[model samples]
Target: MSVFGGMSKGERNRIKIRVRTAMATQTQVEGRYLGGLATPGDGSPLIDAYRRH
Candidate 1:
């Protein structure tokens, strides 16, 4: 079973947005300092995109 199977779609989406926002913020900070750190997951494309907004 999916780990989030019991969650409603809205709940899952909310979680995803929250996580994405946090990651995006982190990426922004790292980018400012030119820190060569790798994010924990899938790099930071989502985060980088979000920062454009």
Candidate 2:
């Protein structure tokens, strides 16, 4: 049973686009954090990522 079975192709494409956009934004933010190039406000995720061992 697929959740998307009732959705139109365009709806599916829009969902995919939104998810891709979110993932790209996340990658950019995380890249900044991991590279130690992030500004002061973006501290929590950077700390968590560094502390994850």
Residue 22 local lDDT, model 1 = 78
TM-score of candidate 2 versus the correct structure, residues matched by position: 0.43
Candidate 2: tens digits of C-alpha lDDT, residues 15-38: 999987887788788763324345
**What are the lDDT scores of the predictions, listed in order?**
0.68, 0.67
What TM-score do all the candidates reach, one by one?
0.43, 0.43
Write model 1 residue lDDT over 1-53, tens digit each, in one string: 56567567769899999987877888788753334544757565434644656
Overall local distance difference test of candidate 2: 0.67
- Candidates in order: C-alpha RMSD to true structure: 13.6, 9.1
Looking at model 1, residue 47 earns an lDDT score of: 47
Error (Å) of candidate 2 at residue 30 is 1.9
The Cα error of candidate 2 at residue 46, in Å, is: 26
lDDT at residue 31 of model 1 (Cα atoms): 57
